[model samples]
Target: MTQFEALPYRHVLTVPTVPTAVRLARETTEDVLTELGVNPRHPTVGPALLILSELVTNAVRHAAAASPQTTVIYAAGEDCLAFGVHDRHPYQPSLYGAATVTEGGAGGLATVMELTLGLGGTAVVRGDADGKGKSIWITLPF
Candidate 1:
């Protein structure tokens, strides 16, 4: 089997549900991509970082009430890089319309979906079977 078809490289990190988690996630993502032979400056890397930031920030803002810990999973394969943020909030993310000027910025999930689609990737939301948490994942083709 080709290397690409073999098992993917995976890393998981548990972080406090705080704003600073976004920065930590981004830095860890860069390190993982580099270790996997994916260039840190690759086109997909920027969007991946942004997606990580948005998802982690959303978890901190929306789910910290349920639990103060969030888990980030990163997986890298020959053709794709995937990241998932698992949070204690049971509610799935709501994708609203484009952010208005008064909203102060683009909606997090909306931006994530847009970036993933633009990169010919996929975005998914999965809720835990126990209904205690949810995970948001984005997979981008490299």
Candidate 2:
């Protein structure tokens, strides 16, 4: 019998706030999913990529503006993968409802929410480390 070592919830990554980071995030996430038997051509891939893009963009734009030294990390647990974007800004992200979703404002947040919901997942935004910054996290069930 072979023993499988249990994984921890601390697979963290800190990437720069540049265009390459965005590409790297999408590619790395796709690779992770594929390595876990998730087909890249699956319908869910589109929305997943879109969510990743929006979150990363926000990090590079808003978060980076407030805190230039931010890094996005991914922590994988037993049944889910959490995508976290941590910035140095000491503020929380707000979620928009259906009205904003249709109003064409707050599009990135809305898109992330919609994609996460459609994929049977949830999106979370909270202040990081004593509320010195924010981390926008989305948990996707595997």
Candidate 3:
């Protein structure tokens, strides 16, 4: 098998469901973005970090009740980067009617949608095809 067959993707990172996982998520994502020559100071970078932060936090908080293990996430693609986080819960998260700057809670999906849209990309979440859990994903053009 060639590299594409052996690896199939570019990067993958996982962290246990803990409070500090948000920081780790941001750091790891920034590292990958930098490795791909994306400037850390770019305006979009901060929102991307926030997207990851909220999504990961939700995974740690609401994804699973019985056994919330480490959150599994990966970033990969050719012309764009896609970030996906899989939590242990299968129930899909509900998005609020609308998002606003004044709102402050239960905005994970809304936040991800806005950030991805701002970056000229898309975000989506669905139940895992394997019927195990759910994976929330965001894709942005480089």
lDDT for each residue of candidate 1 in 1-142, tens digit (9 for 90 to 100): 1222243788999999988888898899888888899877789988888988988988988999896999998877778888789998888865433222235666777787778778888777779999999887777888
TM-score (all chains, Cα) for each model: 0.87, 0.77, 0.77
Runs off by more than 4 Å, candidate 1: 1-7, 95-105
The Cα local distance difference test for each model comes to 0.81, 0.69, 0.68
Model 2: lDDT to the true structure: 0.69
The alpha-carbon lDDT assigned to residue 15 of candidate 3 equals 77
lDDT of 2 by residue, 107-140 (tens): 7787788778878887767776577887777777
In model 3, pairs of residues that clash are none
Answer with 1 or 3, whichever has the higher lDDT.
Answer: 1
Top model number, lDDT: 1
lDDT of 3 by residue, 1-142 (tens): 0122233356767777777777888898888887877778877678878888888888778754733564545555555667777776767764433244344553667677777777887666667687778777776765
lDDT score at residue 70, model 3, on the 0-100 scale = 47
Residue 117 CA displacement from its true place in model 2, Å: 1.3
lDDT of 1: 0.81
